[model samples]
Target: MTLELIDIAVQDSQSHPRLAGRVTGHVRAVLSEMLDGREQTHELSIPVWADIADGTSQSDIDLALMLKAAKIVARLKLSLQSPP
Candidate 1:
């Protein structure tokens, strides 16, 4: 199985200082869970980016990113468990 990180956007980090850490923690937890108890070897790449902008609270952004990560992990896990 292959894991791909499409995109990650963090806006106005200067305004909300904790946004970066929160997002990182969330993504890390998802990845940890996804990789736990797995025996197969796979390729993984995560490319992230940041930018300055406005709008959206930190909590909202965290929730969205976490959900997106969970969905990706679920899809990957299903693919790995299925018959080739």
Candidate 2:
């Protein structure tokens, strides 16, 4: 079945791993849903922001590590300190 092409993929030059991954996930999900079982011709390039993570063939990022770091920083900030 032939389908219509709508919207284009765009990439961000800026490299922010966490935010970029989240954005890429959303874009991929949308395209998958929109083009489900549809046949299309021509090449499509979706611009995804994958910082140095792209250096590796398999792009894998651990978001948990970022969260853990955040939590640790938060704890430090919350720790009772001498009143200034």
Candidate 3:
């Protein structure tokens, strides 16, 4: 899907802002060890719409949705680090 669509999905989560907080928390937890000392940067790319063809399975569709949500959360975190 296009970045605009992904952005829209992220915006939708604003209605439940706590979801963003939870996602950020989980991310921090996962990286806590690596973040303990010194500063580091990492790059990630999540394909929200991959292997989605005419007859994609329901499970695959669900996974794509989850990936899209993850992408949204990552975007939210990055935005937080930006200069305001």
Candidate 4:
């Protein structure tokens, strides 16, 4: 499976220079694991926003983001499978 992230917008998070890279890596990892064994390509262009606490640990943030992303992907799949 192939996943492409066009953009990411985060709010109320840490101000580290590597935060963007970390987010990208986390999202990629999440998608990779979720799409494992699938042979489809995915290209999502939705606006996903998050407001995390400044004091949140990196691990917590990563987990939360991954969970949210996974939920979003699942929902999209469901919608696509639904009949009009």
CA lDDT of 64 in candidate 4?
Answer: 67
What tens digits encode model 1's per-residue C-alpha lDDT throughout 1-84? 344444443322223355633333335321322345463433333222233235766766655655565566667768766486
Per-model TM against the reference: 0.40, 0.24, 0.36, 0.44
Which residue pairs in candidate 3 have backbone atoms (N, alpha carbon, C) closer than 3 angstroms, thus clashing? none
Task: Write the residue-wise lDDT of candidate 3 on 1-84 in tens digits.
Answer: 111222222111111243321221111111111334554444333333333455655555555555665666557566655375
What lDDT does each candidate get?
A: 0.45, 0.34, 0.37, 0.48
The per-residue C-alpha lDDT of model 4 at residue 54 equals 56
The model with the greatest lDDT is 4
Best-to-worst TM-score order: 4, 1, 3, 2
Q: How many residue pairs clash in each candidate at the backbone level?
A: 0, 0, 0, 0
Report the C-alpha displacement of residue 68, candidate 1, in angstroms: 0.8
Off by over 4 Å in 1: 1-26, 30-54
* Native-to-model Cα distance after best TM-score fit, residue 82 in candidate 2, in Å: 4.9
Q: What is the lDDT ranking, best to worst?
A: 4, 1, 3, 2
lDDT of 2 by residue, 1-84 (tens): 223333332322334555533323111111121245764444333334333344433224323233333344335435633356
Clashing pairs in 2: none
Q: Which ten residues in a row have the lowest lDDT in candidate 1?
A: 43-52
* lDDT of residue 39 for candidate 3: 46
